[model samples]
Target: MTHLTLALDAMGGDVGPCVTVPAALQALASNPGLHLLLVGDPAALHPLLAKVDSALLSRLEIVPAESVIASDARPSQAIRASRGTSMRIALELIKTGRAQACVSAGNTGALIGLAKLLLKPLEGIDRPALVTVLPHQQQGKTVVLDLGANVECDSAQLVQFAVMGSVMAEEVLSLRNPRVALLNIGEEETKGLAAIRDAAAQLKNTPSINYIGYLEGNELLTGKTDVMVCDGFVGNVTLKTMEGVVRMFLSLLKSSSTDVGRKAKQAWWLTLIGRFIQRRLAKRFGHLNPDQYNGACLLGLRGTVIKSHGAANQRAFAVAIEQAMQAVQRQLPDRIAARLKTVLPKSD
Candidate 1:
C-alpha cells in the first residue's frame, strides 16, 4: 500500500496483455497508492483497459512499444534489437527514474542482459544473481541465488554468490547470521566440483559469512540452511523441477475435490463436510502453491528488477508485481551494496 510506482512489460509474457492487464488491475485495486506504467503495444493493450474505471485508469498509463523480443531469442541478439521493445522500455523507465522498479515475464536471458547493461552492477559486484526465497516445510524461508543467470561459475564467482545470498537473507529476509551452504552432490567436505569445494573453503574462512557446509538437493527445504548457492544450470533445473512437482500435486488435489463433489451429490451433509475439508486442505497447502513464488528478484543490480516466469498466469504475474513493490520499498540494492564492503575481499 506504499506510494510505489512500477513498470510492467505488458507485451512480454506468453499470454502478454491478457495476463498482465488483469494482474495490473488487481494490483491497483489492492494498493491505493500504487501507480503503474504499462509498457507495450498500445493497440493491443488499450482494448484490455477499455472497461477499467476511469479513476483507476488515471493511476495507470500505457507507454507505447513498437516491438517485442521473442521468448526464445538469444540474449545477445535480443539486446541488439531491444530498442522500443516492451521489455527494454520497461527497463528504461527504471533507468530514467520514471518508475521505482520493473517486472517482466519475458525472456530470462534477454531480461538479464538488458538489466545489467541499463541498471549497471553495484560496486564490488560483477555477476548479478537471480534470488528468490523458497518456503520451507516448517514455514521458514530460505534465500537461494543464481537461479538462471550464470550457468557455469568459477570458484570466485561462486563465492560472490555466497556473499550476495548471505546479504539478501540478512537484509531482505530479516534473518541474523543466515547459514550459507553450497548445493552439492553430498554433504561431505570433498564432495561435488572443485569450484564448489573451493568456494566452501573460502566461505568457511570468511568471518563475515556463516558457512554451514554443503547442502544436498534433498535437504534444500529442510529449513537447515538459510542460503543455498549453486550454478545457474543446476539452480534453474532444481527450481523448475520443484515447481513442476508442486503443480502436479495441486492438480491432483483439484481432481480429487471434483470427484468427491460428484460422489456426494445425493447426500447434502456429506457434500457439506467435503467442502469444509477441501477448504481446510487448500488453506494448509496454499503457501506451497508455485504461483505465489513466480517472481525472482535479479539481485546485484543498482536498481530493482524482477524476472517473472515466462508462462506465468494472472495470479503469478500479480505476485511478481508485489515482489517488485517490496524490493523497492526495502531498497534491496543499496543495502546489499553496503553489506558487500564487509564481505567482499579487498584484493578483488
Candidate 2:
C-alpha cells in the first residue's frame, strides 16, 4: 500500500512542539505506511527532530511556518491574521492535495474557520459538523456530531448532521445500516425543541438513514444508537460533562486505592485485595479515558481536517493523528457527498 501523507500543525495546542513532535514520531514508528509533514518554525522544531531516530527521518519532513495562532484567538482574528501560521499552512497542504489530511490542536473556532475556508464544505452541506467517537456500553463506539461547531442549527441542518454523522459511523466504525437518533430531552416525538421535532419527522421519512427516532441524552453512551445528532451547544456540554465525570470517577478510584494501601500497610492480604480491585477498575475504566479519543473531526469538508484537543498531551495528540489517518483512508468526504446526493433535496 502507498504511504498515507498527513500534515501536522506543529505549533498548535498548549505545549506545541513539545507534544506534537513526539506524537508525530510515535505515529511514524507505529504506522510504517505513514508520512508526516510537520509544519512549524524550523528553529523551534529542529531540536525536537534531533531526538528522533535516523530511520524515521526519511518519512518525516518539516515545512517551516513563521507564525503560530494563539489558543485564545477569536476565529475572525485567526482568519484575517493567521494567513502564514502553521495551522493555516497545514490546512493549505490538504487543499492542494499534497497531504491527505491535516491534524491540529489549535483554537477550535480558528481551526473550524480555517478548514471551512481552505477546503470548503462538501456538496449540499451548508455547514460542517464536528464529530467524535465516544465509547459505548456495548463494547462498540457511538458517533456524536455538532460538538461545538455550530451552536444553533435549524431542522434542515440537523437532518444534514444526521446524514454526515451516519456516514462517519459506517465508514470509521464499520457499522452496517447504522441506527441514527436525534438527541432530545425525552424520547417522545413531542419532546425537544421545534427544530429537533421537525428533524425527527424528516429523518423518519428519509430512506437513506436507519432512522431510530428520538434518543434522550442519557442514552448517549448506552449504545442505544449508532449515531447521536444534536446542535453544537448541547453536544459540547454533553461531551464535556461526560469527560468530567470520567475524570472524577477515576480520581476517586485512585484516591480510594491510596487510602486503602495506607490503612492496610501492615495487612498484606488486605493490601493485595485492594491492589487487585484497583487494577480491575483501572482496566475497565481505561476505555473511558478522554486522552485516547482526543480527535474531533470536522465532517462535511471537501478535505479531511481533525481538531485535536488544545490541552492534549503527546498520547492524546497521537490519537488525533490516528483519527485523521482513518478519515483519509476511508475517503470520508466523498462518502458523505455520495450519501447526500441521494438524500438531499434537489434545491440544496
Candidate 3:
C-alpha cells in the first residue's frame, strides 16, 4: 500500500523495548513504505536503536512517555491513571490523526477500555469484538470473534459479532460471502444457552450474514465455516486450548522423528523411511504454529488497534505490526461501519 504510519506502545509488553524495538526495526526493513512512532521512555528506547542502520532510523521516530500500564492492572485503574503512559500516548496519536492505527502488547483490559473510549465504537455496534484469523483444514482461513473481549454477551451482541466478523473476513482475508457460524456445544438447534439459541434465530433471519448453524470445538479447523462467533469466555479458553494442543502435537512430531532416527541408525532402510515420514508430517502440519498468528484485531471501532500477545517474541511482534499495516491499507474501520449500516438490528 501507500506510505502509512503506525503508533506502537513500545513499553507495554513483558520485556517492553527489548521485544518491540527490534520488531519495529524488522518491520521497517521488510516494508519500505511504513513508518513507526515508538511511544516509550527515550532512555529505554534510544539505547536499543543506537546501533541500528541510519536508513531504518530515518523512517522511525521515538515519542517520549513517562509511564506504562502495568500488565495486571485493572481496566478502571489503568484508564484513570493513563496520562503520559506509553499505551495512552500511542492511542492519542491515532486520535490526533498522526497515525493510522495503534499496536500494543499491553494490558488487555486497559487497551480495550482506552480504545473504546478514544476511538469509539461504530455507530451500530454495541461493543467491538476481538477477532483473529486461523488456518483451516485446507489452505483457506477461518475467522473467530470475541476472543476475550467481552466475557458475557447478550443475543443482540452475539449477532453483532457475526456481522463484525463477516466484514473482517471479507476485508482482511478477501473472502466472498463468507459462511458464519456460532461456536456451540453441538450442531443441534436446541443445544446451547438461551443467548446462543436466540442469536441463532437472529442470524438465521439475517440473509446478509450467510449464517451456517453451529460449530463444535473439534470442528474449528475443519474449514466447515469461514467465521466462528462466540462470547469472550468460551472463545478465549477455546483459543488457548487449541494453541496448547497444536504445540503438543508439533512437539511430538519432532520427538518422534528424533527417537526413530536414533533407534534406526543401524538400518539404512529404517533411517531413510523415518526421515521421509518426519518431512511429510512437518510439511503437512507446519503451518499450524500459533506464533505465526499472534496478532488479533479489535474490530468494530472507529480506528484500528491490533493486540499482540504480551509474551510475543521479535518475529511474532513483527507479524502484529504487519497485520496493523494491512488493516490500515484496507480501511478496516470504514468497511465495518459501512457493513453495519446495512445490517444492524433495528432494535437492541
Candidate 4:
C-alpha cells in the first residue's frame, strides 16, 4: 500500500495530547505506510513522542501550534479567535497539499465552521453534511448523513444530501445502487415535515439514486436502506439516542454479570446460565460499540476532514484516522463533485 500523510489536531479532544498523541502512534503502528503530522504544543507532545519507537518517530512529525479551540467554543468564537489553533493549522495542511486528510476530535460546530471557511464546499454543494457509517444487521454498514452538521435543512438541501450520500455509499462502502431513504416519523408519503416530503418526491423522481421512499426511525440499522438522510437536528438526536441505548445495554450487561456472580455460589446451574446469557449479549452488542464507528466524515467539502467523537479513547481515535485515510485513498470529494454535477438540480 502507498503511504498516506494525515494531519492530526492533537489539541482538539477533551483529553488533548494524552489521547491524540497515543492514537497517532497506534495508527502509525497499524499502518506502516501511514505518516502523521501532529499539530499542537511541542512541549506537551514531546514526552509522548519519547515513548514511541525510534523507527516510528521518523514517521511522526510535530507541528507546533500555540492555541486550541475549546470543545464548548461557539462557531463564531472559533472562527474569529482560533486562527492559530491546532484545528485550524491541521486543516491548513490539507489546503497546502502537505496532508492528504485531516482528523479532529474538536468542537463539531467549530470544525464544521472552520472546514467550510478554509476548504470551502465542493462545487454544487450548498453545505457539507456530517456523514458516518453505522453497523447494519446484514453484516454490512449503512452510510447516514447530516449527523449534526446542519440542524435544519430545506427540501433542496435534503435532496442534495441524498445525492451526496448515495455517491458516498457507492464510492466508499462499495455498494452498487445503494438504496436511499428519507428519515421521517412515518413511512407514508403524507407524513413528516413538508421539507422531508418534498425531498422524498424529488428523490423518487431522480433516476440516478435508488430512492426507497421514506423510512421510519425504527429501520435505521436494519439494513433496509443503504443510506438514511435527514436534517441535522433529527439525525443528531437519532444517532445520540442509539448510542445512549447501546451504552445502557452494555452497562446493564456488566452490572448483571456482577449480580449473577454472588448468586453463583448459592446456585451453580443458574449462575452458569446467567454467565452464558451475559457472554452472548456481550458478543452481540460488541458489534454496535461506538468505538468501532468513531469517525464521521464531513462530506461535500473541497478536501477530506474527519470528525472523531470528542470523548474517544486512543483506540477509537485511531479509527477516525483510518477513516480519513480511506477517504483520501478513494478520492471521495472529487467523486462526490463529479456525481453531483450530473444529478443536482439546475438551480443548485
In TM-score terms, which candidate is top? 2
Q: How close is candidate 2 to the true structure, as a TM-score?
A: 0.98
Q: Estimated TM-score per prediction?
A: 0.95, 0.98, 0.95, 0.96
lDDT, candidate 1, equals: 0.90
Q: In model 1, which range of ten residues has the least summed lDDT?
A: 257-266
Candidate 1's displacement at residue 188, Å, is 0.6
Q: Residue-wise lDDT of candidate 3 within 1-348, one digit each (tens)?
A: 589999999999888999999999999999999999999999999999989999999999999999999999999999999999999999999999999999999999899999999999888887888989999888889999899989999999999999989988898889999999999999999898999999999999998999999989998999999999999999999999999999999999888986786796558777777889899999898788888898999998899999999999999999999999999998989988888888985535
Q: Please write out the lDDT profile of model 2 over residues 65-86, one tens digit for every residue.
A: 9999999988898889987899
Better of 2 and 3 by TM-score: 2
Better of 1 and 4 by lDDT: 4
What value does the lDDT take at residue 113 in candidate 3?
A: 92
Model 2, which residues run further than 4 Å from truth?
A: none
Instruction: Score candidate 4 by TM-score against the native.
Output: 0.96
Query: Candidate 4, overall lDDT?
Result: 0.91
lDDT of 1 by residue, 1-348 (tens): 568899999998888999999999999998899999999999999999989998899899999999999999999999999998999999999999999999999999999999999999887787788988999987899998889999999888888888888888887789999999999999888799999989888888899889989989998888999999999999999988988898898878877865675696657777767678778888888898988888999998899999988999999999999999988888889888888888786535
